[model samples]
Target: MTEQGQSMLNRTVRKRHQLSAESIAKDLQISCGLQISITAVRRELHGMGLHKRAAACKPYITKCNAKRQMQ
Candidate 1:
């Protein structure tokens, strides 16, 4: 990514802290005409000290919801 692109990426990340690499890549493509791969986005994010964390575990159904469904 160019310097401007990198700055844009930083700005984007700052503005939306929960965006994924694929979405960020698509944003860059749409907003700035900067075509980048997900890997590149991830690399840039890593360089910026933004590392990915494992997703939190979620139950398929909450206990309360499951009980309600059974009624």
Candidate 2:
């Protein structure tokens, strides 16, 4: 890939919460004018070892419970 393509990939991957192949492809298409499909993005991410992984969310605690627990 060219410098422009690399830049697009970086930007797309960075913008996402986690490296998402789909978002990367969409961003590349919009930013780099590549018109690439999601599958292509997945392949590229897989090649780069940047495939999206499941993200774990922290448990939510209410403010009242938090205060009580702090006591």
Candidate 3:
């Protein structure tokens, strides 16, 4: 459990992309034969200060910016 948690923690913290807890739990079950739950994966990730978040979006798109971007 701990080794899996460590690997996931490293990946979530160091990588530009993130994996969902459900997928991680599936991987742990398939790759390592550990039948852990999504909640467990979330708990483990939370222990390492990782949390799920959505990518930030810009609310405003100015006409000048759009014109420049087309070029």
Which prediction has the highest lDDT against the true structure? Answer: 1
> Is 1 or 2 the stronger prediction by TM-score?
1
Ranking by TM-score: 1, 3, 2
- The runs of at least 3 residues in candidate 1 whose Cα sits more than 4 Å from the true structure, single-residue gaps closed, are 54-71
Instruction: Please count the clashing residue pairs in each candidate, in the order shown.
Output: 0, 0, 0
lDDT of 3 by residue, 1-71 (tens): 57856785456446535658877767667765777788887887787777897769976779998888898
Clashing residue pairs found in predicted model 3: none
Query: 1-71 in candidate 2: lDDT tens per residue?
Result: 66667667766776764666666677677766888777767776677767567758987899998998999
User: Please, what are the lDDT tens digits per residue for candidate 1 over residues 25-47?
Assistant: 99889988898999999999999
All candidates: CA RMSD (Å):
7.2, 6.1, 6.3
Clashing pairs in 1: none
lDDT of 1 at 11: 94
Q: Which 10-residue span in candidate 2 carries the lowest summed lDDT?
A: 15-24
Scored against the true structure, residue 64 in model 2 reaches a CA lDDT of 94
Clashing pairs in 2: none
